[model samples]
Target: MSDKRVPSMTPPNKAYPREELEEMMQKWLAANVEAEKAGDWPTYLGPMYTEDAVYSWNIGPNEDFVAEGRSEICDIALGFQMHGFEEWEYPYHDIIIDEKRGTVIGFWKQLAPYRRKDGSRFEIAGIGGSWFEYAGNYQWHWQRDFFDFGNAKDCFFQLAGAGALEPVVKKKIHQQAKGALLPGHRKLREEPSRWEKARNAMAMVKIAMTGR
Candidate 1:
């Protein structure tokens, strides 16, 4: 397989000390929460990346979403996903630090405050993680995320079908389904294997939940 890795444009002169790295991460996480809450994406989130940072994620085995440079990362990759999720909480459940490699892996969940049929808040039940390559100066040179698209689709469908989605969000979803690419993002085409994998996983979860 061809190497998918992209070298960092602004490689750090030296790896950050473990304690300093940990402290920086803590501050970053806290700032992220506040940013999300305040809807201050440009001020709070944009500064976390290097000017030449690359952000990417796999849709499955074949398709990938990639955004090169901090502008694309903020305006496209991050902006597209958070379009209507202003109220959603993305709390990291775990973080693995690699001081030697200047990398960190964070496992987080997307949670919505909307009540489900069972009176519980809605949360996508699946794995969600991000890998960050930290450049010096408290900025990231690269980031990639992985998650179960099946669960995300299912949750959104449930909300939309039930008329629980905000009107703006519903409109956005419809637009996306109708082939409107997010700003600074390329055309997104799905692979058969990716669709099948997502569908199968969702089906298994539904069967387990309802014993069907």
Candidate 2:
């Protein structure tokens, strides 16, 4: 299998002081939280990334989403997905810092405002973490995320089943599920049946846990 790991863009010997790195991370997190709250994608969040930064995530085995450079990372990677998800929240619950490597991993959760029949808000509760490579001067040169796609797909299906998803949002999800490529993304290897089976299993688990 080909390596799915993202290569570091910054030099290995170049390191920032632990205190400075912590402060920078705190500032970036605060700015991102504020920008997200105000729905200001081009503001604080965009500035935290370096000019040649890379943003990426894995969809499944051998399938990935990648955005290289600031323009693609900002406009397509971060911007396009926010549509129809105005009420969605991504709150980082934990952070692990590697001072020597100049990397930080942030664990976050994706939450939707739509409530289920059991009065619980629809949420894809799974492991979601972003590994950020610090570029100094309070910016990151690389950011890659890992998350459970099966759980995410199940949440979306539940939303669609309840007629809670907007038409445009539903269409976008359908297109992606059918292997349509987004801007700055590489061609995806089709595995619709595998994804569907995973989603089905996740949905059954969710139903069992929620009793809904």
- Which candidate should be chosen as best, given lDDT against the real structure? 2
CA RMSD of each candidate after superposition: 6.1, 6.4
User: Tens digits of per-residue lDDT for model 1 on 160-184?
Assistant: 7777787778877678679564444
Global CA lDDT computed for model 1? 0.77
Which regions of candidate 2 deviate over 4 angstroms?
A: 1-13, 188-212
Lowest summed lDDT across 10 adjacent residues in model 1 is found at 1-10
lDDT, candidate 2, 1-29, per-residue tens: 22334555454646668998899879978
Local distance difference test values of all predictions, in order: 0.77, 0.80
Q: List TM-score per model, in order.
A: 0.77, 0.81
Candidate 1 error regions (>4 Å) = 1-14, 60-62, 184-212
Candidate 1's displacement at residue 185, Å, is 4.2
Score candidate 1 by TM-score against the native: 0.77
RMSD of 1: 6.1
Clash number for each model: 0, 0
